[model samples]
Every structure is written in structure tokens, then in C-alpha cells.
Target: MPLRASLRPGDTIGILGGGQLGRMLALAAAPLGLKTHIFCPDPQSPAFEVADAHTIADYEDQGALERFAETCDAVTYEFENVPAGTAAFLENRVVLRPGARALEISQDRLTEKQFLEAAGADVAPYRDIANEGDLFAALAAFGGQGVLKTRRFGYDGKGQVMIRAAEDTDTALERIGNAPAVLEALIPFDREMSVIVARDAAGTCGAFDVSENLHRNHILHTSTVPAGIGPALAETARAMAIRIAEAMDYVGVMGVELFVVPSPVGETVLVNEIAPRVHNSGHWTQDACLCDQFEQHIRAVAGWPLGTFERHSDAVMTNLIGDACDSWPDILRDPSARLHLYGKTESRPGRKMGHWNRITPHQAGNGSSGQKS
Candidate 1:
């Protein structure tokens, strides 16, 4: 159910994950007079430092979940992998924005693809693989080159393997732990982009500018706004995101990743995947837009009116993965560089330690021009 009344300044919000996303969400809530309570099993959760309160317990801890829910006006999650039982447990007691249905669809690759296709959205061709035979057949179907990704609990290039013709299928399957997986045809796309949109209980929606993304080792490296796609294609992507939000009756921020395929007539956008929360690509909004993605999510979950999604400048946001954050001093030297660190005690390879957004004056008449960085 939706919130009966907008959350007041002092109402505490419960967050289900304690990563950097949760940290950012807590920070966004503070200025609005709202407080956050982070629940995670990890003692070193970065979000715990910024949250007003925290519970270090497993997601399945019944006693802990009850106590945490009792203190908040609403609950939301920073990541998609929140155990299904955990989400259902809270939905009955508190307002859980975006709800369980969105989680159910997005937690599995096959389910997400089916949901998108049913909603009339185009997606990459895919097949489910349960065993080696299934993998071999699916590989042949895709002409022997595709990506095999685990059905659940995978992100940032983890839980996946690439299938190349003549490669050992057994070795590839073992890499994913022989888990239930989906084989997606390796789409030869011209570029990748994403649209971050927010929807409220009243059915109102708002969308930020399209962000062209570049990835390295399957992890997002940078996201730049004014993604050089022509205005028409950009609008098409935005419209698709809105359609998805409405289809899910979604009441929070959603990140819709798309693959831009070059067609004979023009560029076409295909739904790559759906993230049911604020996205890494949308981080650029922190400095460039009047209402950043984090704040937009807070407003939606709190049942407040969605804020304007206008960009005041052109910006590029780069992820400070692993030791990349070691250059904090150098980044600080540039006055125009707006830096944000996740407050992690230590960093490992491919871990998102932090991100920085660099903004520039919006060129005259090119208000929303297309550019790639």
C-alpha cells in the first residue's frame, strides 16, 4: 500500500542495504529533516556511519527485522538482491516503496526479460540454461558466442561468463558454479545508455536526462549527460522508461539500462536491464541536475511531490573504483571537480570506492546537446 500521508521531517526511514548507495541515500535524507536506519549484517557497512541508527543483523533475522520496522515510517532498499522473504516480511508492516513485485521480476534475468517483453519493450534474445546440454543448445542458438549469467545475486561483472566457440563449455559452466543461468546473445550495439526515472504514489513521474555510459571489465566506468543520441532517440528511451515504471505501478526511482543499436534508418534502443533503485549511472545528477536521483528517490518513497528533473549544467561522473580513490588529493586540486567518497575502510579491485562529478557551463542553445565522454 502507498503512504497515507507524506512523511514528516522527523520520521525515520528504514534502508535494507548498507553499501555506498545506502550511504548516499542517508545523506540525501538528512537535509530534508529525515533520518535513516541502516540494516545489514556487515559491521563495516559504510552506510552505518552516516545513518542516524543502524541494526547489524542478517536479513533473515526475524527479531531484528521486527524491531527495525517498528521504528520507521517507510522502508526502501538500495540494492536489488534483498531476500524476497525479507521484503515480504516488511511489506505487511510498513510502506515499502516499489514493492515486492518489482523485486520479484528484477531478481532473475529470465523473469526480468519476460516482464519487459510483456510490457512491449524490446530486449536481447535470451534462453534459460539448467545444465550443460542446455548451455550447448543455447550457445548454438546464439551462433556460439553469448554471455552466461547467473539468475540471481550477480552484479558489477560477477556471476557471469562468456561463451566463445571452441571454448571449453565445461569450464565456462563451472565458472558460474553450474547455477541456474540465462544465456543472452552478445548484442553488437553501437553504445550503451540509461534513463533514471521516478514515480510517486499519485502516478506522477519525472525523468533525468539520458546518460551515455562506458564500462570496463563489465563495471561502469563513467556516465556523461548530453549522450550524443539525437533528441528523437533520447525521447524514445525516456518514454520506454516511463512505460516500464507505469507497468510496474512503481513508486520509486528506477534505472533503465539500454543498448543503442545502429539501424539502417536510425539508432534503436533495446532494454538491457532494469534496476529497481537509484542507479550508478544517474550519479551525475548529484551535481548537474536541480533534483538529484537520490533526493528524487527520497521524495517518491516519502510520498512527496516529485522534483524538477532539469539539468543546470553538462557533467561527467567517473566511478572511483578500488585504488582509483587514492587520487583524492589530485582530484581535490581541481576546484570544478565535485568528489564523493563512500567512506569504506578498505578498497578491493573492482569495488566502487567513490565517485566524482565534474560540471561545466551549459552551452548556449545546446541546452541538452548530445555529447559522449
Candidate 2:
């Protein structure tokens, strides 16, 4: 069942969601002598520009999904929001990595928290919110402070509301359109970090270095390598990521978002969320390590042996959100900066246009200290 035997040169891989991640995956595949076919509803998808072939049709269109599945040796998605029906259709035909169960678990907030906890991971206290009354009781249980997030379709601060006081609950449910939700106690985490782990067909696992993340307006701003955490804690994070992957029989690169919270005994690492596919936090690995995350993912899905991801230098990867990409000309002037721009024609606030990584030769005894350029 390990689809490893027939992946020769020029095999076509089908990718769902024609976005920047898909574009990066296609770019990575070229060196391995692979071709990519992109499938998405958007005709103007940026990935369409780089992929070897593409199908522009809605995910619900059975005819389109059938045609797309026939052309690829393996199918993987760039985003977790991929529809369950579409993934199932592809799985019955071609090979699908990090399969439908991974998408199903990550697509719902309540399910994700439960899955992580069952996999022996620490998670924040939470309760399902099916109605306004549930929200009131759950928020009160967390001492009048909790974040209410919709169980489905929530990302980048969307479909969520922060309740800081009793008075703020008046229209909290209305804000998210009264969708099924979950209320989580907000932990005053010391630092936000993430670990990207790859699990191949043989169940072998390897994790990239931790990234100490910084967010602005609920969007990731930068990820600095050699996270300020100690080595032992970093290992704990890596082990946690591997456990989660094995629990789901996951194949491909997955990102595990984590929170470092201080406790009386020591710093408690909590599972913040899981990304079923390649992630934003792992962008730093692209320049810092020889086997970047995008390529690692391609290798895993293609059933090739995973590569080493050890970094030779410290790196700071900053996401160019919205109009921030407008300064590309200025940013590219730095002789050492590596710039990556997603080929999107229009830019709006909070849109992730691209990113750039600045690396310095590894400094002895000062790996964790870094800032974005």
C-alpha cells in the first residue's frame, strides 16, 4: 500500500488549492524531475502561473475531480480547507498523503483540540459552544475571559471573537454568525513557536528546528530560528510533533503550532493547533537548511527518502503581508537577503504576498538570538 514503487521521473502530482504554497511545491518538484497539476476553483490562481498543468473548476464538480485525479500519481493539498468529498474522491482513485482524516480533524477547532489531547498532547481547557447560552457558561467558567472560535472555517483571526468581560457577550455569537464553536481559556503564553515534522511512508519521522513566532493583528509577521527556548524543550516539541503525526498515520510535512506557557514546575508546552500541510512557520527552513520544508513535503508525498534539515546558519523569515510587499525593491537591495514573492497581481491588507529570509553564519553560543531584517 506504500505507493513507492512506481514514482519515476516525470510522474505527475496533483495539488489541491492553487495558492502560493502550491506554487512553492511546484517549484520544488522541478528539481526532482516531477511535474505538478494544480486543481482549484479560482481561474486566476497564482499557482496556475507555475504549474505544469491546471484545472479550473469547483471542488464539488464530480467530473472535474475525476479528471484531475486521473492525471496524477499522487494527490496532496496546499490548504486544510479542502472539501472532504473532494479528498475522498481522489483517495479512491489516486494516492493521497496526510489523508482525509488529517483534513477532517484540522478543519474543525473542537475536533483538533480533542485529537491533540487524545494523542497525549497538552491543550488549553476548552468547551464546545453550540448556542449563546453555551458561550456564556463557558466564558464564565474560564473566569470571564476566553476566545470563542467557530469549529469550522476559522483562520487568521477570522470566525473568532475575544470575550474579555461580561459586557462583551451581548453580540458575540452574532459576530461569528452563530456557527458551532468552541471557547478556550486564553493562556498567557510566554512565547509562540512551531515545529514542522515530516513523516514518510515507512513511518520514519524528522522535525525541522523550532521557530519562535511573532504575530501582528493575528497574522504571522516573522519566524526566527533557534527559538529562544532551551534545547531540551525544543526536543520535547519535536517529539510531540512526531507523536501527533504517527497517531494519524500521517504522510507528508505537517506543522504543529505550540505555545510555551510558564508553570510553577517549569515551562509547559501546549499544542496550539495543527496544520495538515506545509506551514507558514516553516518558511525559515527554506533558506536556513539544505532540504527546505517545501521539498521535504514533496519527498514525503512522493515516497522518497526524507532529507536532512539541519541548519548551517541562523535565520529570520518575515512574511510580507498586504502592501508590505510593495517594498520588495528596497528589500532586495540587501546583498544577503533571499526574497520570495507570490505572483499575485492584486494586494490587500493582511494578504500574505510573500516572504524573505535573512541568514547569518551560525554564531557559537548565540543561536537563539535573531531578528527579522
Candidate 3:
């Protein structure tokens, strides 16, 4: 079934994961006179603090899910790795934004690449790795170089290894727990960029400015808007995002990561990964745009009109990983800096503690100015 009407004020929205994304979504909902119910098995979920209501139960707890679903006018998830059974149960009971198909495709690398290609987006060459023999053959074909990644549950450099030689294949497979994986041909390219796009039930699409990203230790380090990719390349990135959203009939905000590589004709982009929910790369929108990605996602799921994604400033967003968030005082001292801290204690290495956005007056003639994609 599809959404036939919009949700009204005070309606409850259920979220599947209780992380910072869910917390921010709940925060975005309050001003719209909406409420949120967070459901996660973690007792100390960061979202649990901000949500109006919450249920601490496993995804397989049908009884708990039933009670939670009945309270929500519509439902959306914060993460893409939702249990198929859990998503199926919710889909039958209430509206689930981005739907089951989006969840299924985004959960696996092989399926995601195929979907991107069919959607008319360029993607790197990749092969499914079912065994040690398969991995070795794929690596050999790719010039003894490729990225071996688990098909599911991999993020922030987890469940991934670089296969630079035949000798590295055994250890690479062992690192990923010998799970089914995909070996993608290495893309020798320029910078990394991502486009954040939102699609409503009525098929209206809105996309934010492109973000030029930097990564460290396989985790995102910074996302700078305007991407400095010039107008043509920027438009190409956004067009690719729109095509993907239309292809998926996506009903919420999504992040489309890309590799902006140099082609024979000119600089072009290849779709690297698709995140079915609000992305870390789009966090800059919170401070730069009038209507940020979180709000856009909520509007789409609730069947409301999309908001303005126009930016008034050029901004750089940096993730405060681990204990780096301890410098909140210095960050607060900077008048142009907007700090956002995820309410999580015990920050360990590689953990995403929070992020801050530094905004400056928009400079004109930089390719993206007063343009809404």
C-alpha cells in the first residue's frame, strides 16, 4: 500500500534505530508539532533521550513491535541494516518510508551496484566473491588490486580489506569473517563527493549542494559543500542522485556517494554507495541550509511538502571522532562554528563522537549559488 494522505500535527513517527541520526530526526520533528517513538534494543541509545516514547526490545520481538507500530502514524528507519522480518512486519502494519525494496538493495553491495547501473548511473566494475577462489580470480582480473568488502553490515572501514597482492587474499577473507563479499576494481580518481537527495510520495525531488568529502582510517573526516567541482560536474552529481531516487521510488532522504574521476571527455562521477537514510556527509546541511536533510526526511515520510534546500553560506563540516570532541570549549568560542554533540558517553577510538560545522558568508560565482537541484 502507498501513502494516501499526509500525517497531521502531533502524529507519532516510529524510528527503528536509536543512534544520533534518530536523535536528530526526533529533534527535527518537534518544531513541526510531531512526535517520535524510538525502538531499539540498546538500553542506552542516544535517541532514547530525545524521543517522546521508546521501546527497548530486539527486532525479533513481534509483540513489542506490534505495540510500537500501533502508536505510530507512520514509520521510518535510521539505519539501512534493518532486519527483513522486522521491516516486513512494520510494512504491513504501518507506512514505512523508503520501503522494503530500498532496504534490501542498500543492505548489499552487489545489489546496490546493479541497481545503480540499471538506474543509468555509472559504477565501478565489481564481481561477487563467494569463496577464496572467487576472490583470487577477481583480484587477478583487476590487476591484483581491488577492495574486498563484505556484502552486508560493513561501515566506517569495518568488514573491508584492500587486496593488493595474491598473498593478501587469505588474510582479507579472514578479516571479513569469510562472509560473502564483493571485489570492486580500484577507481583511480579525483576527490570523493556525495549528493543528498529527498523524494516525496508525490514524486517531487529535491537535492542539496554537492559535498566534497575526505576520509581517514576509512571513516569520513570532513564534508565541504559546493565541492568546488564547477557547475557542470556538480549538476551531473545531482542528476545522478535524482535518477537514483526516481529509480527506487525512494520516499525519504538518501545520500549518494560518488567517485569524481577524470574521464577521457572530462571529469565524471561514478556511484560508489547509496545510503538509504540521512548520511554523515549531509550533516553540514544542518547549519548551512534553511531546511536540512533531517527535516527533509521527516517531511517526505510524513507526506508534507519538501522544504527549501538552498544554502546561505559555504560551510565545512568536520567529524569529531573519539576524544576530539573534548575541544567543545574552543569550538564554542568560534562565533562562526556550530557544534553538535551526540549524547554518548565513553567515547572510544574510531567512535563518531559528534560533528561541528563552520559557516562563512556565501561567496558568489563559485558554481553553486542560489541554485536548487
Highest lDDT: which candidate? 3
Cα error, candidate 1, residue 105 (Å): 0.8
Candidate 1 on 25-120: residue-level lDDT in tens?
A: 999999999999999999999999999999999999989999999999999999998889999999888889879999999999989999999988
TM-score for candidate 2, please give it.
0.96
Greater TM-score among 1 and 2 belongs to 2
The whole-model C-alpha lDDT of candidate 3 against the native structure comes to: 0.92
- Give TM-scores for every candidate, taking all chains together and pairing residue i with residue i: 0.95, 0.96, 0.97
Off-target runs (Cα >4 Å) in candidate 2 are: 1-6, 365-373
Clashes of each: 1, 0, 0
Writing each residue's lDDT as its tens digit, candidate 3 over 1-373 gives: 5644589999998999999999999999999999999999999899999999999999889999999999999999999999999999999989999899999999999999999999999999899999989987898789999999999999888888997776887799898999999999999979999999999888989799999999999999999987969898998889899999999989999999999988899899999999999999999999998999999999999988888889989999999999999999999999999999999987999889899999998888775643334
Which parts of model 3 have CA positions greater than 4 angstroms off? 1-4, 369-373
**Better-scoring candidate (lDDT), 1 or 3:** 3
Q: 226-281, model 2: which lDDT tens digit per residue?
A: 88988778878888988999898898999999999999989979999999999999
Cα misplacement distance, residue 40 of candidate 2 (Å): 1.3
Q: Could you say which candidate leads in TM-score?
A: 3
User: Which model, 1 or 2, shows the larger lDDT?
Assistant: 1
